[model samples]
Target: MAALEGRGLRKQFGGVVALNGIDLDIDTDQVVGIVGPNGSGKTTLFNVVTGVHPATAGTVSWQGQDITNIGAHRIARKRLVRTFQQAMSFPGLTVDENVRIAWEQGRRGGSRWASPAMILDFVGLAPLGRAIAGSLPFGSLRRLGLAVALGVSPELLLLDEPGAGLN
Candidate 1:
């Protein structure tokens, strides 16, 4: 069975049809990229699959289980996590604190990285762990977002525009 599957997925915002009849199957350990022009429904696809937004039609299955519109938090607990296009963090908190919270809130038993520090290191943000999240540069913020997603110990990670703020 595919690790992740979306069949006939469609999302519409009022009259705007963001996705139409999209079908995809991702196998275990497979790296897939969805590329399209601006406003081409890439983010919408991620939102639908990850439960950030409800699909207007179709289904999303993870490990052969129906997970469509199950809610984002529940999906995260299932070890499926995603990053946002915009770098997301608690502005008032230190970088370390932000990651620590992510780890605490989303920590499951099977994380590849053993701790929050490891996740920061993996994203090249260990040195700035003490810095306030709001004070960081754009690229660092993007990396922080990635680190936060990793802190959740996801079995499957969907990164949206991961390279957006980076060189």
Candidate 2:
């Protein structure tokens, strides 16, 4: 059985069809990429699967159980995590603090006060750990985003346009 499967998934935005009967099967420990031109429904598909948006039609199965309309936090508890195309950060927080927040929220195995130094080192942000996230360059912010997602310890990681703004 596949780790995740979508059967005839459909989503509509008013009169426009965002996803039309899309089907996909992903197995454990596999690397799959979804590529297409703009407005091809990639983000919509992720949103539906991750519970950001309810599907207009079809079913989603994860580990043989139906999860089509599960809430986002519920899905995350089930080990499915996703990252946005645009890097998101708490502008007022330090880089290390931002990562720490994610670590705590994602419920990774660690103390709430785990060494910020260690976490920064693990994500290659040691040098910038003390810097304010809002003041960092775009590339560094992107890395920060990845580090935050990694903190979630996801079974399934969905990255949307991870390289979108890279120079």
For all candidates in order, the CA lDDT equals: 0.90, 0.83
**What are the clashing pairs of model 2?**
none
The TM-score obtained by model 2 is 0.87
Error of 2 at 66 (Å): 1.6
lDDT of 1 by residue, 1-167 (tens): 79899999999999999999999999769899999999999999999999999999999999889999999888878888899998899999999999998788665565566788998998999999999999999999999999898887778899999899886
- State TM-scores per candidate: 0.95, 0.87
Candidate 1, clashing residue pairs? none
Candidate 2 residue-wise lDDT, 110-147, digit = tens: 33335656667775788999899999888788878877
Each prediction's total of clashing residue pairs, residues at least 3 apart in sequence or on different chains, is: 0, 0
Worst 10 residues of 2 by lDDT: 108-117
